[model samples]
Target: MNFDSYASDVMAATVEAVNQLTPGHARGRDYPAARPDLGDLVGEAAVSSEDVDELRAYAFKIREIFVAVDDNRIDDACEATNTLLAETQAAPTLSRHGGEPWHLHFHTPSERWARGWAAPMATALAIVLGNPMHDRLGVCTATVCDRVFVDVSRNGTKRYCSTACQNRVKAAAFRARKQV
Candidate 1:
């Protein structure tokens, strides 16, 4: 299930950024009002207020992709992905930062959060579309929970974010079958 090393890193970072931007327990904090750290990832490009708005929209779009996948609505997921892909222009290159080795990268020179996110996200989608890994994008199966994950596992079999959620789902299912 390994993609190209650089693509894997970029996808990993993309997932992290999505999690950071989205409200969730995994982050251990509420979503920030201002994410200066996002600017670092996007580079020194000009980011407008509109760009931030758009980024939020796209974050929700990513959320929709997860929900659609959970519902087994592949058409909706594909449509959402196409919308994101249309908004992005990802080109791959190599760069070094934070003492990390040179790696495959994709970006635009915009400082705006949404614009900055577009390229990397688009690149991640490209990897997913090109490889079997695309099926890995999914939502948690726990009842009353809606978290997303990119299951980059050898078995393509990740169903929940934590054991707690797994147990919750199992318990719920057991109760449902008993009532039936």
Candidate 2:
């Protein structure tokens, strides 16, 4: 698979991290009780409690990239992503792990958990933002959720993070119609 595919996964994990870490008043602090299973995608090792704290803090900033793009503020989105890329000191290198083929990686392999994760994600967003596919990034339209999403649908009409959120919205609309 292309290394760019990892960018999609990075966006997904970052969204989960943001939504779980910063739920609105309607919900209590729902910061994920545990680290998300990004192992398969990002090859995350066992993270320390310190790593979790750093990840939580960084996730909020990552979410801003989607929110800015969704709001049609392309410049803002690019600026934010650029700042993140700088903060993480993202640098590209090629390496092969185990039996896998060589692929591009951003950030030093010896970096801390948070730096390792953030660098690649920022790099990926920078790549997307620099291309015509920038519209693929979005924040969920669901009022109750602010999770980020990538519109991979053919027509790119996606507005919610997942079917669960879409169903929730549709169900609410139905209830409103019934009341009327």
Candidate 3:
């Protein structure tokens, strides 16, 4: 049930990055934003208005890649994935930062926000590729929602992104049965 330590860290970071970009909980929930420049693991830099829009679009693109991976479409999934990987120049290494001990690192020093995202994402996927658990990357099947997640559970049986959605679907099923 254990994954590579490096890959595990990268996956955790990828999830963290996505969460930073679009928090999973209710909208407008107050949470600390990622600071990519201040040497924080989640750095913070001034993002332009246009950059915000671009990031949102890129998030959806990432979600699409996850969906492709889940559907067993390797060519389509890797197409989008390779674009991200090539753009970011993701490389693997072990380094220490922020007083932490040596750990796997996967980013070059760059000020661009896109590079900040691409590096970590590509590194995370690389970890998945190296291990058999690459199948963990997937999108939720909830209608009207397309959020991505890394299934880190021991049972490998995660489906929805949150309890609210699970409840929503359950309630719909109950209502249908009652009507019948």
Best by TM-score: 2
Candidate 3 total steric clashes: 6
- Which stretches of model 2 miss by more than 4 angstroms? 1-4, 25-44
The lDDT values for all models are 0.65, 0.74, 0.62
Could you tell me which residue pairs clash in candidate 1?
45-109, 45-111, 47-112
Compared with the true structure, what per-residue lDDT tens digits does model 3 show for residues 30-126? 4333432212343556667566555545555666667777898767877777787777677666777679888655665443576656577666675
Candidate 1, which segments miss by more than 4 Å at Cα? 23-54, 93-102, 110-113, 170-180
- Residues 73-125 of candidate 1 have per-residue lDDT tens digits of 77777777777777765666677777999766566433346655667776666
Error of 1 at 6 (Å): 3.2
Top candidate on lDDT is 2
For TM-score, candidate 1 versus 3, the one ahead is: 3
In model 3, what is the error at residue 46, expressed in angstroms?
5.0
Cα RMSD of all models vs. native, in order, equals: 5.2, 3.3, 5.2
Error of 1 at 59 (Å): 1.0
Clashes of each: 3, 0, 6
Q: Order candidates by TM-score, high to low.
A: 2, 3, 1
